[model samples]
Target: MMHQPMKHNRPPMMKRIADASEPYLYSAPALILIVAVMLVPLVVGISYAFRDIQLLNPFSGGFVGLDHFRALGQDQAFYGALRNTLWWTGASVFLQFTFGLILALLLDKPFYGRGLVQALVFLPWAVPSFLAGLNWAWLFNPVIGPLPHWFYALGLMDEPHNILSDPHLAMWGPIAANVWWGIPFFAITLLAALQAIPRDLYEAASIDGAGPVQRFWSITLPFLAPTIAITVLLRTVWISNFADLIVVMTNGGPADRTQIVASYIFTQAFKRLDFGYASAIALVLLALLLVYSMLIVLLRQTMLNKG
Candidate 1:
């Protein structure tokens, strides 16, 4: 009995061990690499908030705890940046989701060249953000801009000059550009959600004499609610930190009216050479993004639990 105990188990033992954890081991390298790359820069940037650094001494700076945060509190630019960021996040996400939902619902029905039309609508989002900004810049040009030309040609405006320079529309110009840039993403996501919805629900509703309006209000929208809410949260997070369009289009210009948190932090740190203060501002932005994301996650989880 004792001699038979070992039982030549090495092959089966090796197979069992491999089967149990080889997948996790295979994934370990990528997980570590991602964590190091992402977390290191984030930690370094956050640490700078406690220091009093400037471009003149980028390599070394003194610790000045909370000073930068204090400075940012009194900075009018901070408040302006915050205001514009809220406007960007709220207005762009709202309009983008609205139009996207409409486009998705329409496209959900069978039609000719539907694929082509959807692709065409999505084309604006396919272009690089910087290029989109440049195109918008030209479109808003006062003298020879296409939009002003069309507008003035149609007798819509008094001038054919730069519309972005107009105080009334300058900030809005970026929002519209951002919205256009953002719409396709929402459409694609919502369309995928719409397509996944059970067709029998619609037929049942129709058989019950539910009109198009009633069906949509009752079935279509409720099914889409979770997806829409998540997308809005994500879009808000994205626009809050999106600096490229604002940078290339307006440079947060025309007197800093278009300045958002990201661009402002960039200006304070690199442009103004106030590293510490910029870090402080960046931390605030990070905190804001954290709050937004947490709320989205918690709400989504709650909804899922309720369901």
Candidate 2:
């Protein structure tokens, strides 16, 4: 040290830079692919929202600024779609979470035919969404479906009729199918969370004279809270943008009673050939989703802090 550390050699600047960037160099391919596949299309779609881009028009790709957004602001059908979106997302998420938690709780304990029951619970998730929609549509059809007959026998319906064609009840059809298909997601995730919980906590709670409900509220729920918040947020976003089942089952039919924002975008883009308008709608939906996501994240953080 007294002799200037024996004139120890250091790598040149270029060599040091290369060594520092080794990790990024290895990840460069994935980054490039992501930019090309996701970022590029995202930028292009955002540009479309500010232009006149009709697929049928030969010279339609012209900048229109906020014209599409202004028109969207005045579209009554778009407003109706917003309302339906709330109902659809709310009912579907609520029912799926409720039934899924019950199923998960039941499956957490040993029982006869538990394996078969679990398989059946997860079967709907494996089925294609389009196929599931079609199957549910058939099940709601008065001509061939037994549901209407069963409802009639239960004194719940005036007659065996196709509820999907009835505007008053048409929304329930897709909601029911969505709940059935989505329950498996919540069930699987919740069951895993349930299993991860330590047996000692349950034993300790029982020793302290905690009842089933008390134990669940005191121990199980606190452990599952984080998982629940994340799963609910993900499901909410996915379901809000999901139009496949609605398009396949109802096509926003019965006077567009089932039209949601996602399906509305599809109708504009494909049926009307109005790419600009569709992009504008999509941009708005994206903004809304971002806001919702921020709220969920903030709430989760607050809960974590309190805990």
Candidate 3:
């Protein structure tokens, strides 16, 4: 019988080890950075949530268990902030997405000076949140800003009054500013998704006697569904945690009318110098956001499966 040639079933042990270790070696730096930057602070903050960590007190870092949480449970201001957060997040996300989608659709069509228009449209997003807040705050100022006067002229207001100072309308000011600043994010993402869609699909729909609305509903929207879901999810989480515009514009003023959970956390940590309470609030907010995110992801997965 002919002697069978010896077969090599695997690479050398050292080679296999090197191959297995290569990916980890390449990823080690990023893992280390994440741990150092994100994970370390996260662990520390979680620990602080269970302790007394006032910055002004020399001996404040003592373990306090769930006292902070118990206090939070009874804090009516926190409850108010939660309600305001819902309104702020809901209105901001809705208006931003609606206007952004419209802007994206308009820009997707060929037009004169499309580049200039796109640049101008996306300009707000590039502006620092602090600057944007200041600008919007100025605009809402009856003394310096033209918006109040314009509204008065339009009969939307009885007089050219500063809406930012009105507790009933103060939240709207921040929400409006946030919508203006955030719309571009949705627009850019949606525009990219629109461009990625196959041209033939729209053409085919047109050839099948579909009208503009029909084509949009049947072709454009289905393709955009996933992008919309993701962008909305991200924007919701971000806007919930966002405090810059609110802080700069109203400082959660006029009776804490504009105070969201994020601004409340800022107040606790910086203004009150109560790091432990702030950490506890932050931890709760983090948990709530995680839950919201998981629900959205599950919903998206269900939709994708059905589709």
Candidate 4:
């Protein structure tokens, strides 16, 4: 009777192989979709940079290597746009992140109507970028909006003149609009990261006689560092590529003072119908962004290693 115990047989090798491949088979459709939707377009865009692809010309599909880049190298507007892009990206990110961090800290504290306050603060982010740009443009107009009058009242201007028409001051209009629209994104991300920090750690620090500033530096900042770094990187790239507000508000106008690289690309593509040139500029921008991202990642890795 003891020797009569039956043994179970293992599944065939083919069956095991099929089971192992089942997860990949299930995910294949999504992977294919991503490649079709994102990767194919990117590859096509890169190809366009090397070929003449004017939107209106039916016979403009001829390959012209490096001609667009050569032309771009001599374009003064492109150079100006590059400088404007630096100023635009830097100012927008700094102001947005600064105000966002402040707002997140304020929201972290429990208070009456906290939820309502958060919703209101985040409302601007939901507005369409073009509409936000138009709204800010109106605000700068002296005839219809209050900002100009407010500025004049504050003695910052001789009259309620529109700053968007002033080449020196025009960049600020889009930058200001961008900051207002982008702050909520940073605040939402930072607030979530802040809330995820363990309460016990803060309590322990307090129990050990750590001051508020010290606790923030030691506990809060360290926990938020990774989040802040990633968020800043993503926002930097996004804002650099964002042309909607600038195009809608300034149209790269007032002598192209507010024109950034993204807007410049748009001008070449749509206004001039030079898709090849636009794609060339876009490729250069893509290269710069990749280099910038790689540097940031390497720096972060080095800091992590040292820590």
Candidate 5:
């Protein structure tokens, strides 16, 4: 064969391998940190669900298998917590989404002092959860706050009494606080999605003699369906797990009327020193959330297919 031109020297195979792996090497620390911080704790927590892990017990490391689950099945307090969780999550997500949609719609229109209005409305979301709970608790108090007085004046209540003391209404105290703080989150997210919709679609719909309601039903609703679905799902999960307000405001008091599963878990873990039982309850909650999320996703897929 004719003398071939000498091939240019290339990097050694080991060097090439090292070069290809350099990016991964750079990211290795963060990857290790995530595994150490998140994955390790998650695995440990799941393991704890199956073991006797009382915090104060010296000899509580034995694997008990499904014992905690069996006890949980017979626990009436857990059942009550489950029901309260449903009520709390349902009311909070509904009211937040409703008022948030309204706020987003209102803010979508150009107006004077729009920025100021938006900032004021979103202020509650910026407040710390503990502070928000305290603020709302105070507001519900008749001693220094005006809400009870307002309710009394409106004849909703016979006297200016704190609703947090009433078992029937204690859940509503945290729910109201949750709704106020969470509304801004939904408003911000939905407003962003609203702004992303093509203005031309609305213009075209208007040209076709579509009124506001018709335009909303025909164009706006469909565009917002995906965002609304995702937001509602996320908010449902978050509100279900949110125990800060309940803990700070009521501590699941009024005879445990305000106790949701999350606060119940807290009660089990810290108050009762039953870490294993708390982990079991958390595992159950996680399973329920997974199932609920799956159902929602399937429903969304089916609706999209039909549409």
Candidate 6:
């Protein structure tokens, strides 16, 4: 009597290929939709950046070289728009991350009414941007506005403060509005990350006689570093293009001190009816955004490597 040899059993490579192909069998439609809807529009915008587009008719425009970008080099308004855009990006992102982190840290602690406070704090994010902007726009109304009334009551103003017209305050006002509208989103997102942290780590730190600050520096921040980096990246992108809030609130008035790149581009294209020039502005903005996005990816990778 002899034991029979076991037969080797394995699917052929061709069968494996057929199995993998099954998933793509249903993905073709989605692929088509993505290409047609997203890729086509992006390609068209990129193409226009190289053309002499007109407001009257985009198709009738002729091809132009890099004159648009070259023109931007000599334009003062473009420079102003760039400066304001930088200010907006820097201030809004910094404030959003700072406040959001504070809220997240506070909410991370155990307290009564924690759930209610979190839900209430996140309410600003639920409302639409335009609506929130409009609400702030009204609150700053010079004569009848609550802001002016409160300032007067507190002896902070001899007269009503013209928020929209004051060069010093105009930009900050919009920044405040945007931060208010944006904070809750960051809070909720960061809170989720905080909650995902392991309790055992904290317990171990406590057992080692670590103080609140020591435990936070060693355990908390390191764990939340990735989340903070991601939040900064996302907030940067959104805050950079925050035009609806600005436009609805101030329309970039008072000698255009508060005009951001997006609103400037809008005014140039739609208000001035100079589509070619506006396209150039838009192309420049696109370039900056691309650079920022790349920087974000690099920073994220660096942070990830560190942790």
lDDT of 6 by residue, 1-307 (tens): 0244536465668867887898898898999999999889877877776778776874657888887778888989888988999998899888888898899999999999998998899898888889988888888887666897787789877887867778877887788888898888788888889889999999998998999999989988888888887778777877787788888888887778899998998887778777777878887888888898898899789867886
Off by over 4 Å in 1: 1-30, 55-59, 153-156
* Stretches of model 4 off by over 4 angstroms after superposition: 1-30
Error of 5 at 265 (Å): 0.1
lDDT of 1 at 137: 82
TM-score of each: 0.87, 0.90, 0.92, 0.92, 0.88, 0.88
Segments in model 5 whose C-alpha atoms lie over 4 Å from true places:
1-35
For model 3, state the Cα shift of residue 104 in Å: 0.6
lDDT of each: 0.85, 0.94, 0.95, 0.94, 0.95, 0.83
**Model 6 clash tally, residue pairs:** 0
Clashes of 4: 0
Tens-digit lDDT string for candidate 1 (157-273): 887867677755678778878888888999999999999999999999999999999998999888998888888887888888998888888888878888889999888877889
Clashing pairs for predicted structure model 5, backbone only:
none
Candidate 3: where is the Cα deviation over 4 Å?
A: 1-28
Which lDDT tens digits does candidate 5 get at residues 1-307?
Answer: 1254536566568867887999999999999999999999989999999999998899998999999999999999999999999999999999999999999999999999999999999999999998999999999999999999999999999999999999999999999999989999999999999999999999998998999999999888899999999999988998899999999999998998999999999989999999999999999999999999999999999999999
Task: Report clash pairs, candidate 2.
Answer: none
Number of clashing residue pairs, candidate 5 = 0
Per-residue lDDT tens digits for candidate 3, residues 195-281, read 999999998988899999999999999999999999999999999999999999999988999999999999999999999999999
- What TM-score does candidate 6 get on C-alpha atoms? 0.88
**Ten contiguous residues with the weakest lDDT in model 2:** 1-10
